[model samples]
Target: MGQPPINSTGEARTIPVIEARGVDHYYEGQGGWNHALSNLNLTIPHEEFLCIVGPSGCGKSTFLKIVMGLLKPMRGQVLLEGKPIEGPGTDRGVVFQEPALFAWRTVIENVEFGLQMQKVPKAEARRRAQEVLDVVGLGHVTDLYPYQLSGGMRARVAVARAWALRSANLLLMDEPFAAIDAINRMALQDYLVDTWMKDRRTVIYITHDIDEAVYLGDRILLMRPSPGRIGRFFEVNAPRPRDRSSAEFAELKGLITEEMHRFSSENTSIQEDAA
Candidate 1:
C-alpha cells in the first residue's frame, strides 16, 4: 500500500478524491518497450493540494493523464470519487502548459466555453465564469482576447476556465505556469493559491520545480524513475500564504530537492554502467 494521504495536521483524510491501485503503464518507443509507470499506488484526499515532483520521465505526467482519463494503465485501475475512470468526463478538468485559449474568444468567453459545451444554460455559465474569474483576479479583463493578454494573464484565464466547471470537482494541472517568466510565474502561483483557498478542489499539480512544489502543495509527492514509482512523500506543514523565504520552507524544499538529485544521480550511474 502507498502512504495514505494525510492533511497538514497529519491526520488521515476520510474522503478520497482519487485512488490509484497497482498502476503500471507502458508504450512502444524507438527504444522498444518503455515502462512509464510501475506498481504505482496513491490516494488524494478531498480538496487537497497535491504537488508531484520528479526528474524527467518519472511518470508524473503519466499518472496525471491516467487521473484525467486520457490514458489507461495497462495493469491497474484509477478511481475518482470511488468510480473507475473509463474515459474523460465532466468530473475532472485539465489545464496543460499552454493556455490553449481559443484565439478568437475573449477571456470570459473562453472560460464559459466548457460549461456551454456541457449544455449549461448561458446565463448560468456566464455567472460561473465571472465568479471564477474574480477568484483568479481576472474579472477586469474578461473581455480581452487571448493575444491581448500577457502570458501570466493568459495563464490565469486557463485556470479560470478549468475552475469554472461546476461539475469538475478535480482539477489536474500539468506545469501550467512552466512557460512564464520567473517573476510572473511566482505571481501566477499566488493567484492559484488564492483561488484554491476560496474554493477548495482536489488538485494534482505536476511540476519540475522544487520551490514551486513546496510553495503550492499541501503534500509533496516525490517519484523515482527507471520505472517510475513513489519515492516518498513530504508534508508541507507551513501555514497558507506560505513565506517562501522562511527557514521552514527552505528546509522542506531542500529536502525534496536533495532526494530528487539523488534519484537523478543514481539513474545516471545505472545508465553509465549499462553502457
Candidate 2:
C-alpha cells in the first residue's frame, strides 16, 4: 500500500522512520582497518517495507546494525523518527537468520517475551501475543513448544514475536528464512506480507536473494562492495500479492541479478589488479 506524503493540513509532512546520513563504518581486517560502509545515506518513510540486497562484504548487515544501534559507526549518524539512534531500544524489534526461539517456552510465551520485558501486564501481554500469533496463522499452535514446531512454524513464531511488540514501530529482519527450504521460505514470505498488510510498520529486511527482495520490498536498495555503498534503489510497483512468474517480476529480478553480477565482476577485477 502506497502512503501519501501529505498530512491533515494538506501540506507535506513526510518525516522518515529511519534516516542514515553520510554513514561510515570501519573494522580491523587482515590489512589494518577495512571500510565496511562508506558515506552511505538512506531514508525509509513511515510503514515502508524496504529490502536490501547485495553480495558479501557489501555492508548490508552493517547498515542493519547501524539502524539497530548495536554498533556505532565511525562517522555520520542514523536517525529514527528524526532523532539520532543512540542505542538499542524498544522502538525497534529484530528478527535474525535463526529463529532463536526459547526451547523452554511455548509459542505464546515466546511471543510474549518481549512484551513482558517491557513491563506489560501479563494478561495484556498474552492477549497481544495471541492476537499477533493469530494474525500469522499460528493461533492453534500457540501452546506448542518451540521444539515441537516445524522450521516454517518457528519462523512464523519469530515474526509474531517481533510484531507483538506494540511499541516497536520498526522491524529489522536479517535473513529470517534463509535456513528454511525454498517452498517453506516462499510460504513464510506470504505469511509475513499478510501480517505486514494487517498492521503496517517500517521494515528493513536484508537478504541475499534477489527474488525475495523483489517479492517483499516496496523498494529494494542494492549495495556495492569494496567499501560498501549504495549502488542503486529499485521501486517495486507491481502491487501485492505479486506474481512471481509474471514478466514484470522476472524483469525486476533480472535487473537486480545483473547489478549483483556487475558488482561481483568489478570486485574480481580489482582483486586481480591488486595481485
Candidate 3:
C-alpha cells in the first residue's frame, strides 16, 4: 500500500509493482555473440495483466526469465515493489510451457509440492491445494497420478500448484496452456482470468497467440526478434469476461493484427534497404 516518489510537477503516481529499466541482455553462441534483449523497459502497476506476444526468435521468454530473476540482464535493472530483484524470490510464481509435475505424485500432492518443500504446515498446505484444485476444476481428479490425467487436466494441476504455493506479488507465465488443444486452452484461459481477478497480482504472461493475448491481456506488448526489443503496444479497453464473438473483441484483435503487419513490413523494408 506504499506509493511511488512524487514528481517535481507534483502529480502522485501509484508505484508500479514491477518496473524494468534499460534492460539489455546477450548470449555468446557458435554464431558469435547474440543479443537476446535490448534496452527493453516497461512498468506494470498492481494487479495488471500484461501479455507479451511476438515472433519465434523474439525474447519473450527471455524477458519473462529476467523478470523472474531466473536470469539476469546484461544491462538494466528489474525492480519488484521498489526493490531490485537480485535473484529468484518467493514473491514470484512461475508456470512454464510444460506442467513439469512429478509423475508419481497425485494431483493434490503435486499442487501441494512446493508448499511442502517450503515447509508449510501439512494440513494448511493440503487445504490450500484442495481449494486451488477445486477452483481449477481438477478436484475430481485429485487422487489421480499425472499419467492418468488428460493434457488439459495436467495443465490445470500445474497452474493450481503455482497459485497455491505462494502469496506472490507477481505471477510469471510462459505459454502455460499452449500445449493443450483449443477447447482446453479456452477453458484454462477462463480459469486464469478468474483466479487473477480474485487475487489481483501483477501478472506477466508470454504467449505467441494473438487471440490469447487479446483475450487475457489488459495490454499487449509486441516484441521484435533478433536483439529483441519492445515494439508496438495496445490497450484492450474491453471489459472483463469479454465476449470473444462480440464486435468490440473482433475490432481489438483486428487492430493488433494490422499493427503487426505494418511493423513486419517496415522491418522488411529496413532490412532490404540495408542489404
Give the Cα-based TM-score of candidate 2 against the true structure.
0.95
lDDT of 1 by residue, 74-190 (tens): 999998988899998778888988999999999999999889899999999999999999889888998988999998898999999999987888999999999999999999999
Rank by TM-score, highest first: 2, 1, 3
Best by TM-score: 2
The regions of model 2 sitting more than 4 angstroms off are 1-12
C-alpha lDDT of residue 264 in model 1? 87
Model 1: pairs clashing at backbone N, Cα or C within 3 Å = none
Q: Which lDDT values do the candidates have, in the order given?
A: 0.90, 0.91, 0.85
Best-performing candidate as measured by lDDT: 2
lDDT of 3 by residue, 1-275 (tens): 23443534687546787888999988887879888899988888776789999887678998889888889898999888889998986678888899999998999999898788788999999999999988888778899999999898888888888898666777889999999999879988999998877766778999989999999998899998777899888888787788899998888888878877776777788889999
Better candidate by lDDT, 2 or 3: 2
Per-model TM-score on C-alpha atoms = 0.93, 0.95, 0.91
